[model samples]
Target: MSKRRFIAALIGVLVAPLLTVVMPAGTASAHGWITSPASRQEQCRAGTVSCGEIKYEPQSVEGPKGLRNCHGNVGRFAELNNDGKGWRVQNVSRTTTFRWNLTARHRTSTWEYYIGGARVASFNDGGAIPGSTVTHNVNLGRTGRQKLLAIWNIADTANAFYVCVDLNIS
Candidate 1:
């Protein structure tokens, strides 16, 4: 056999096995949530707050992009929108470093933080795949028991992950 034909056959032999392997369809592989300073979902997952379905899947609070609410406007995780849930406030300096623990990595567009309908900080990723963990030093302008909304905008999709972190800044 010719060298070209032999290489073609070898490639087919190696690739056929991989193609035969089955994978579940419609599986979501990219999800993330804030852990440090404990977003509401993290607080729920850690038993620091009494929450609903979000406790089991803290990284799944995904919804349409450009939304300002927590829980991503999802009905099941809607508990994140409640202010009376006795959420714990983390004390941090004016410039706080928010840490994200990503369950799966994806191309990121931007990370935005909002408080009382005002945007405080935004980090643009230029549509690059993020690492399993991501952190940003955000200057939260206001102080004294503020609920900050953090949004991770996906690069290709119209979806974004949302988390709310309550903070008491000094």
Candidate 2:
């Protein structure tokens, strides 16, 4: 099967069984929460999650019980046109096993993953970089909120790539 089809099939397989767990059917779907724009550069004036901005400028929201609201603000270096290659965020999820699905184009540049404002994983070091849809799992236990900033920096200068995340609260 083609890569695209394979990704679709994989997503179907992964989400199909998840649908069986009834959540008392209600207006609010109990699935993972996703912000709009689906990209950092896109203008998303809605949602409790705001990206592409420095300093903890977040939109408030009612998160699930035990699931703290994650507000990620890229550091000044992470801002567009910044020369430095470092990115940072303030308090996100103080303590939790946060899993996020990052849909990005498969490339050679290093793709880092963070949760609650700390570095958790990277996709260049044998990490899977799905050109279509891919999920990165990070388990942050007993860690402070300052440990959840995931950065995907390119070793070489290149056009900014779109990175969208879907957070699943357990």
Candidate 3:
């Protein structure tokens, strides 16, 4: 083959794999959210409520694990943390099941649920990779309306995803 043609072929071989490695397929699908009882983001995704950019990518609200804000501290998803955004509260039993719809599973540290200002339930994953779908049954143990915060902690990362769910328990 000609030297110029050989050089061009070599460049393609080197650059093609780097491009794939830099941007792997489905890397955008790297997390999830609580779908059951519908977190605010889920409500946006389902058209139960109007929202901003989060409506397009509800599973992407990742932030530090210890914070108590929605949008996972992401400014673009800040609408999720808004109190007067007209989110519909879902009615549930005292004991309700939360379902996580995971697009990409990661090694998880824990899953925590909080109501008002108190932690009511937590599941420890012990650094194991979780399934695409996860469910947790939480005993709310109280009646009336409440706002719930659900957190998914990643074992290997310094971040977690957050979801704020409104509920009316009976």
Name the regions of candidate 3 deviating beyond 4 angstroms.
1-27
Q: How far off is residue 34 in model 1, in Å?
A: 0.7
Q: Give the alpha carbon lDDT tens digit for every residue of 1-170 in model 3.
A: 99999999999999998998899565477589989988898999998898877888889999987988877889989888788989999999999999999988989999998888789999999999988899999998789999999999999999999999999999
True-structure RMSD, every candidate: 6.3, 17.1, 3.8
Model 2 Cα lDDT, one tens digit per residue, 1-170 = 89999999999999987887755543321112122213222212232234344212222111222221232222331342221222232233423332323333333355454454455565663433444333454544444323233344333333222232333322
TM-score of each: 0.83, 0.32, 0.85
**Residue pairs of candidate 1 with colliding backbone atoms:** none
Task: Give all candidates' CA lDDT scores.
Answer: 0.91, 0.35, 0.90
Q: Which segments of candidate 2 are over 4 A away from where they belong?
A: 1-45, 49-106, 114-118, 125-129, 155-170
Please provide, for model 1 over 65-100, each residue's C-alpha lDDT reduced to its tens digit, 9 standing for 90 to 100: 988899888999988999998999999999999999
Candidate 1: misplaced stretches above 4 Å? Answer: 1-30
Candidate whose lDDT is highest = 1
Q: Which residue pairs in candidate 3 collide?
A: none
